[model samples]
Target: MTLYYAPRTVSAAVAIALNEVGAPYETVKIDFASSDQTKPGYHKVNPKGRVPALITDRGVLTETSALLDYVAALYPKARLVPDDPFQAAQMRSVMTYLASTWHINHAMGGRGARWAYQQSSFDDLKSKVTENITANCRYFEDEVVQGPFVLGNQFTLADAYFYTVTTWLPSDGVDIADFPHLHAYQQRMQARASVQKAQSDGFF
Candidate 1:
């Protein structure tokens, strides 16, 4: 497997999951700073022109949630997903929220151009990031996170996904310290070997 990723992006979640499963893979850095993801060469790899495209033996896989699920399925012994159906659905629900809601909220701060053409509109979107992301953090604190992990006690793929998104909190103008549960969750996730490996590898 070969993982194409950009630092400080949600792509880090996939790298952490691969490491958690002890999967052997090489990483190709997609330098978003240089517009590498938009180049034709990369477009051939992923027509969406985005990072976190994984080249597996079967085919290329994009999207963080799908890739995480693939990794968990490939290495069931890693138990990156819950065995119970309801718990598994709960895990997917959180991952979906991260991808569809929380991440979009954060993107508006910097990627506002994707949504609007007007400068004033960009500013409006940027202004809302702090409030939107803080609300997301609050939701995770009061409703989402069950305990030590997203599902409590057991470390699953959702942790990798949640941890990566949470890393954006400080830059999104929200302090992790404002949410004790999430702050502690961040600390615990940082201590994990998979996360340490992802960080050391420059996945962020």
Candidate 2:
């Protein structure tokens, strides 16, 4: 498998999952800094022109949640997902929230161009990022996070997904220190070997 990713983006979640599964895969860096993702060459890999596109023997996969799910499915022995159906659904709920809500909020800060045409509108979206993301942080702290991990004790794919989103908090102007549980959760995730390996491999 070959994973196309950009550093400091949600793509790191996929890398972390792949590492957790001990999967043998190579990474191809998509340099967002140079607008590499927008080029026609990358569009062939992911027409969406985004990072985190994985090339498997079957085909290419995109979207953070889908790729994470695929990795977990390919290596069930890694137990990245819960065996219980209800628990698995709960994990999906969190991952969905991260992709649909939390990540959108963070993107508004720098990716306002995707949503608005006017400069003022862009500023408006950027201004709301901190408040929106902080609210998300609060939700995770009080409701979503079950302790030690998102599902309590057993580390699920949601942990990798959530950890990737939390990485944008400080840059989004929301201090992680303000949310103690999430702050600790980030610390716990950082201590994991998968996360460490991802960082070492420059998937960060």
Model 1 residue runs over 4 Å out of place are none
Tens-place lDDT per residue, model 1, 1-204, is 999999999999999999999999999998888999999999999999987999999999999999999999999999999999999999999999999999999999998989999999999999999999999999999999987999998999999999999999888999999999999999999999999999999987
Alpha-carbon shift of residue 64 in model 2 (angstroms)? 0.8
Assess candidate 2 and give its lDDT.
Answer: 0.93
**Residue 104 error, candidate 2, Å:** 0.5
Candidate 2 lands at a TM-score of: 0.98
Mark the 10 consecutive residues where model 2 has the least summed lDDT: 162-171
Lowest lDDT 10-mer window, candidate 1?
Answer: 144-153
Q: Tell me the whole-model lDDT of each prediction, alpha carbons only.
A: 0.95, 0.93
Clashing pairs in 2: none
